[model samples]
Target: MFFRFACLLLSMLLFSGVSRAEDPVREAQAVIANQLSAFASDDAETAYSFASPNIRSIYRSETQFLDMVRKNYPPVYKLGNYAFGRSKLVGGGELVLQEVLISGEEGQDWTAVYEMRLMDDGSYKVNGVRMKRNTTSEGI
Candidate 1:
């Protein structure tokens, strides 16, 4: 029941396109999807643009950032499938927690907790992501 409610709330946030103009869930999804799509298409520039300012600073260059993602987040770069799930608002909506179900190249199952941050442009960017491999009897 809780999962259903959370999914519904996230769905509302995702489709409403700036719900109340205060919630940034839609922007978060857009940025994440855009970056991932860029990765799939090998478009480093577009993917780097979706990252938060802090991430941009850390990576310092598009090539550097793209290499890091290709090396560290292979699943996100080459996913078999993915879907957004529950989301939680934090820091009065400045930050958000988004759950993602991801299947990797070899069909490895993972749950990604995406940390989203609202930017000055009235949009959201991906701040960080932590992935956990899901262990289940029924393999993905």
Candidate 2:
């Protein structure tokens, strides 16, 4: 029947559209991994390539960004180990929030939360990073 054929066509179109939706979390993870690898190898240019346009605009050049990272986020530059914890899509998939744990040579441990934006190119990149120091209270 024509009705049956039309219904099947519609179902297929809907499924295809849903499947085309981008997975922001996965994209963000890949970007983060690329950046981390660059940092580990001291490849500033490669690491800067992973930065979002907004970040690149703020820093102007890869060298400047590298200097800022080395001067400000020393621990991240010296990071020895890291683990990606949890990632969630928020605001109806417009934003991705992820948490990462990092350890450095000085026995320093840090937890960082990243807010990523879904770019028009179907990729995700970090827009902001909020770091927290992991510590315990010295109680009496």
Candidate 3:
């Protein structure tokens, strides 16, 4: 049993390291997905932790940040499903712009463009999001 536990621990450590080595686009998308999951459970602190320093500076507190998201971004705050759309690196690879096509809880389609900035600690954080109502019949 001890040998089996050792092997499992090693595998977990290796997998965790490999996950962080993913490309910038995937990394940014992962951060966004994590934040959305946090919102689904109303985990304000976890959701706010994914925000960039600039955003955190403005919001100041987790409650305030979560409140803003709930008020201004209903689709993201309560999503049914989401798919990754277009993605590109900007600012000389320091930033990733990713488009997420979301189906809201109320069945409305929306597009959320997220700007993710690479922080000094080598993690990407959500800098901002620009959301627009999908006027077309396209589905994600």
Candidate 2, poorest ten consecutive residues by summed lDDT: 131-140
Show the lowest summed lDDT stretch of 10 residues, model 3. Answer: 131-140
TM-score of 1: 0.79
What are the lDDT scores of the predictions, listed in order?
A: 0.81, 0.77, 0.89
| Order of quality (TM-score) | 3, 1, 2
Tell me how candidate 3 scores on lDDT: 0.89
Ranking 2 against 3 by TM-score, winner:
3
Clashes of each: 0, 0, 0
Per-prediction TM-score, please?
A: 0.79, 0.76, 0.81
The alpha-carbon RMSD values of the candidates against the true structure, listed in the order shown, are 10.2, 5.5, 5.1
Q: Give the per-residue lDDT digits (tens) of candidate 1, residues 52-103.
A: 9999989999999999988998888887788887778887779988877887
The reply for model 1, stretches above 4 Å from the true place, is 1-20, 135-140
**Model 3 backbone overlap count:** 0
Q: Superposing every Cα of model 1 onto the true structure, what RMSD results?
A: 10.2
lDDT-sorted candidate list, best first: 3, 1, 2
Q: Pick by lDDT: which candidate is best? A: 3
